[model samples]
Target: MLMTTNEPQSILDRSGMTNAEAGALYRLLTWLSPSFPVGAFAYSSGIEWAVEAGDISDAVSLRGWLAALLADGSGFCDGVFLAQAHRAAETGDDGVLREIAELAAAYVPSRERQLETTTQGRAFIEIARAAWSYDGLDLLIASCGGTIVYPVAVGIVSAAHGIPLAPTLHAFLHALASNWISAGSRLVPLGQTDSQRVLASLEPVVAATAGRALLATLDDLGSATFRADLSSLRHETQYTRLFRS
Candidate 1:
């Protein structure tokens, strides 16, 4: 469990991470990387529609949009699922894992959103098992009934691989924000430099999101970014589009 702010730091805090932690960190980087073959590039998670609707047209607006997503929208909700899945996996509680996986799958606001998350989730699991096979990976797979959502897929694998929750949660949210920024760069036609700038500006939002998720339970899972969800819902019938969601 996470410690409260009033408590002192654990003596286990070290000046340098151990070899095992170093390895786990490397795995997280690889798994969440844009080139991970999860086909994450094929979906924009509704950023395509937002750009078309002028909700995001420049670096400034894109930054603000992503900040909200990472804080009060699907980003935070996914982080909560990820953290919960991680805990369930760590404790070998398939019952809670099943509930989380199903809830995450059903939580999408649109068909495309559901398609975006579950398709990538399925691919994520298949690839991870192929390259980094672990015995415990199937625990959540069985629980989700083959319809795993992306963040929960990642959380389960991360825990089974011995990755600690804090860094894994941080990396997951960072990758999420990064992917949305990538979609915005293409849709808004922003310069690569500006895209990097927008991502850099979101570091704090990502950090705070992961921190809250680390302490959150299922009761805290919800989204308030109505526009973002509406964009996703309306994208289904959009006249023109370049993304799958």
Candidate 2:
């Protein structure tokens, strides 16, 4: 979606950006920073359920679960949606963007998964509007007639702000993986050292998944994390749960 090449080009100079590249980097940091008010801490994406079910009881199990998730599950599906939405926003194709938004909202396999995306998406939009307003962003918002998903909302905003696609997608996937790792840390009762180790081990997988997502299309969107999907559905009625999803 974003016109990109393996060759390294100075985005600051190539895009005619008046500010230094540091400004763009800072924007990405702030937007994706853990302190950002998307309420990501409230949802576990079914990791809590997985923990309770003993599917993720240790660092090794957690890492494997997250790897599968990043490689072929919601992570892959969301990446395709984000890339498509970003392309639509970049091209000023409101119709395509709207269609993508609706499709993304409907793509989730369970009710909690739906809430997980839509709630965070609504929060992300509202906070971004108040903190970093832009003409292109406002246009995208006006065109989204129904509920928006988190990845689609983020894609539209990132594109509107002139952020490059590959790094944006990579950062997004990394952030999600980190969040899941954090959830696993708490749910698994792993120490900080073990948590960091798990995160470190997942770097290669994260890179591989990001590279795959960059070249993936909407037709490639599908989930093979059968247990993960079942876990999310099971979490709906889970007793004594620690996460919202």
Candidate 3:
């Protein structure tokens, strides 16, 4: 049975969010969920090679690797792109949005890395358009043209649906960290508790990365995680592999 209430106090919680805000939050949760069918699990973002190379054999090392990624590598670069795309879409500036999308597509460091982001990017656009779209989501995506980078796709969708960028950035980074941590868990064969510990330890790194990305401009996009980049390249020819990248 459903109970209807006219009182805002009765319907709303201490957070004081209106129904629109609450619904927007729910959409973010759904779009970024691990089971959202974007094939995120198929890509490890180089964790597979990191494990094989013994760079991530334990929780502490795993945390460190991810911290670098969040602070200086794809995490930071992608976040910048995401923010740019979000603001561009929010302002109805397709020119800026298209440029950001192109940069993200060209920013990948390896063949498989490009495959990983763009493949998921295409899937996210198609899935969201089919099930969760607004009037402008498809238009923004179509305007961007060519291969849509995943972060750009996410940013566009977030803006199109009126989801605020701060929480969206945090959630997006958190989800990326979670997926990579999951890959690390399987490859390192870590106990479930250890995996949780690794993820727990990355909170500050993710928060700081999201904060930087919130203020970042396209000019700030770059990466210095050379070893991590090599891992993605090495994964291409590794004798045995379980991840796409």
Estimate TM-scores for all models.
0.91, 0.91, 0.95
Q: Compare the candidates by lDDT and give the number of the best one.
A: 3
Stretches off by above 4 angstroms in model 1 are 1-17
For model 2, the superposed segments whose C-alpha errors exceed 4 Å read 1-20
As for lDDT, the candidate ahead, 1 or 3, is: 3
- CA lDDT, every prediction? 0.88, 0.87, 0.91
Locate the minimum summed-lDDT window of 10 residues in model 2: 4-13
All candidates in order of lDDT, best leading:
3, 1, 2
Instruction: At residue 116, give the lDDT of candidate 2.
Output: 90
How well is each residue in 1-245 modelled by candidate 2, as lDDT tens digits?
79766343455567665464556567777777778889898899999999999999999999999999989899888888888888899999999889899999999988998999999899988887787788768889777778999999889888888888888888888888888988888899899999999889988988898888788887788889999999999999998988999
Cα RMSD of predicted structure 2: 6.8
Cα lDDT tens digits for candidate 1, 1-245: 97565222232234365557667877899999998999889899889989998989899999999999999999999999999988988898888888888898898899998999989888988998899988867765787665899999998999889998898889899999999989999999999899999999999999999899888889988889999999999889999988999
